[model samples]
Target: MADYTIRVYKNRDYNAVRMLFAEGMLEHIPATCAHVLKLPRAQFVLFISFITLLLISRSYLLSLVSLAIVFTLGRRLLTSEFHQYVESCQRDDLLDIEESYMASNNSCFWVAESNGRVVGMVGVVPRSSEVMLLRRLSVAKDKRHQGIANALCHKVIDFARQRSFKALTLETSMVQVASHKLYEKLGFQKTDVRVFPSLFGRFANFSVLTYEYKLRH
Candidate 1:
């Protein structure tokens, strides 16, 4: 909260950026679990399964076993989802950030510095000739409630405009409610909500909300 400056990504800030991203993302697990449990399919399956087991055996042990099984399945499903997202991040972006972002003239990464330390970071990767994906935005946990995130976002938006991008967009999980607020405050509008396809996506049952900031003349 004292003072912070936003600057282009430096090689030295890579590790800090990675750590901030991992920590910020991992913080969503609990929220994701709660959201998953509230889904209609989860409630129906858990209730029916438990009730059926109770009526068939009436044994507390069997009922508990059934509960454990169902709960474990849900937990494992979410854990797998978490890992998949993390792996995708590492494989697609974080692993070779320089090669993935720095090497390209259209892609750029930035970090927020305070007290001479990397406290926050954000990046923009060109998704098409006219669009950029605003991604990897995060701030240190202890550094929240400050203006670091806002500054980082402003910097990314300016960068996009200066580079003639037509729009800036991002995807965030439903669990990332706080981020949604930030994006909205920055003039990004929620445009869509979608879940990934395939068995794992069905089992885990999470939705990603997409937001877009259309640049205007």
Candidate 2:
């Protein structure tokens, strides 16, 4: 396996995280669009209109102008109240699995870096005296299947074990089968189903699957 370093995220690493998210968003644009379709009607209309403008503009100057408008509108849409609501839902989901890792407590966050560039990350938050919740596990597309996630996960598991955590829990969506399989391969067992109210309210209905792993000394 290629050597990589795992460390906590730093203030300077914020940009790297943003870039990674942007790249992942672009990679999953089709799925992202499908998710966007679940937005409220008004939001959907605005989003579709922007896409229509991007597709229909012909002349170079007109296209550039339309692109600029689209970008401005896109930024507004991303930062709008509805968007914030959706983002909060996501954050809540993450917290539901693990909240202690968010700049507080004895929780831990690890980022996998190779040649000085971040390639993956995992977040763990203490849930109780003997359990921790793991969330936001991700690996860049180019780094997938290369053990980056495995290494990061192992590091967190080791940290938790050393701290005397007896169990680790996580939640993953059906859309993320690979992640589910990874968790299973890491010795996690299916625990139960989690229902996020915000997700159900937005997507009409969806399921969040939960998993757990018992640590052994």
lDDT of every model, 2 decimals: 0.84, 0.69
Residue 172, model 1: Cα distance from true site in angstroms: 1.4
Name model 2 segments beyond 4 Å from true.
21-86, 89-105, 199-204
TM-score of each: 0.88, 0.65
Q: Residues 14-117, candidate 2: write the lDDT tens digits.
A: 55665564454344334434554465864666656656765787465666677667656644553353355445544653333233354565587778888898
Q: Over all chains combined, what TM-score does candidate 1 have?
A: 0.88
Candidate 1 lDDT for residue 79: 75
Q: What is candidate 1's CA lDDT for residue 216? A: 70
What is the alpha-carbon lDDT for the whole of candidate 1?
0.84
Error of 2 at 99 (Å): 11
Worst 10 residues of 2 by lDDT: 93-102
